[model samples]
Target: MRANSKEQIIEAAGVVFERYGFKKTTMDDIAYAAGKGKSSLYYYFKNKEEVFEAVVAHEAEHLVNEINASINVSKPAVEKLRSYVNIRMKRFVQRGNLATALNDNFLATFSFIEKIRNNYRDIEIDMIGEIIKEGIEKNEFKPVDTNFIAEAILTCMIGFEVPLLTKSNATDESVEKINNVIDMFFYGICT
Candidate 1:
């Protein structure tokens, strides 16, 4: 077995956790996956919880980086918001470990999971709020409470997670539904 780096351990642990979940997974499983001894795992992390936290943090950081990159384009605020929604939804599904960590009720047993989720939630709200503020300043969108609208959009996103994860073929139909919802958010229902 190679001398596994901490990142390697975390990456391996993510796979193990995704396969067996937080409770069912053990240090041995992570070690085997990382091609390291169980003792080597301890050198980097105190326990499975620490490893799992690292994995979640890694995934969350990756998601934030992608979101920031996608939204930093020269497009209008409306396009930035649309890009945010598309990337967030797409990545949320594609990143299995993060999705499992956030969506699985069982993982809620880890208290840190809630903290990580709350941190991500706050970041999401702030980013959306900025986009809304930009939209209002440019008169691309009507003046509204940015925080309220951001929170509302986040709530809708949270509502979409479970159903999207459950469906066997969710991508196309889900994207259409999400776009429809965005259009409704932009345009009034009275039409």
Candidate 2:
């Protein structure tokens, strides 16, 4: 699709930010990447921070949509939970390079970015909580505190980011590890 000027600028800014991270990327770099003049970029985005915020929002929305779609399919709760973890891990592996960079620095100093991250986490937890509720209602999963379980699942998934993002290549081993975590979550570690 043909993106508008503002969308073009945001897309270009995402690329630049991913390459150089939030602090190092300049408006000029975004303008160059977008093939627009610096003034045009400024006209679209007041500054680099605005563009970066837009990028984070865009990525977060994309993730939420993907997770929702993955779980929305007609499947058992166990299947849905497994799909959720796999989809989340794959996306993290795909986008985590840039995300890790932005998170390591911007998450501490930028309250706006921090809010965006929290909002994303909240959305994820809500989605996972709904699945857990369904599982309990259907007797597929034992009755547990859905909120607590959702939060624990989210936390465990986030923990995978460190090892998954650090890998130069996401091999089958990465997929196996994520599935193993899901298995442990569902069935417990003890035989």
Say which candidate scores most in TM-score: 1
Let me know the TM-score candidate 1 reaches against the reference structure: 0.92
TM-score of 2: 0.88
Question: Candidate 2, overall lDDT?
Answer: 0.79
- What would the per-residue lDDT of candidate 2 be over residues 1-191, giving only the tens digit for each residue? 33588888887888888888777889889999999899987776787777888887777777778888889988899889888888777877776433553347645687777777778788888988999999999899999999998999888877777777788396457767867887787899998
Per-model lDDT: 0.85, 0.79
Q: How accurate is candidate 1 locally (lDDT)?
A: 0.85
Q: lDDT tens string, model 1, 1-191?
A: 33348878988888898888788999999999988899988987898888988898888888889989999888899789889988888876674778877887877888988987888889999999999998999899999989998998888887888778877368667766877787788886776
How much is 41 displaced in model 2, in angstroms?
2.8
* Model 1 lowest lDDT segment of ten: 1-10
TM-score, per-candidate, Cα-based:
0.92, 0.88
Off by over 4 Å in 1: 1-4
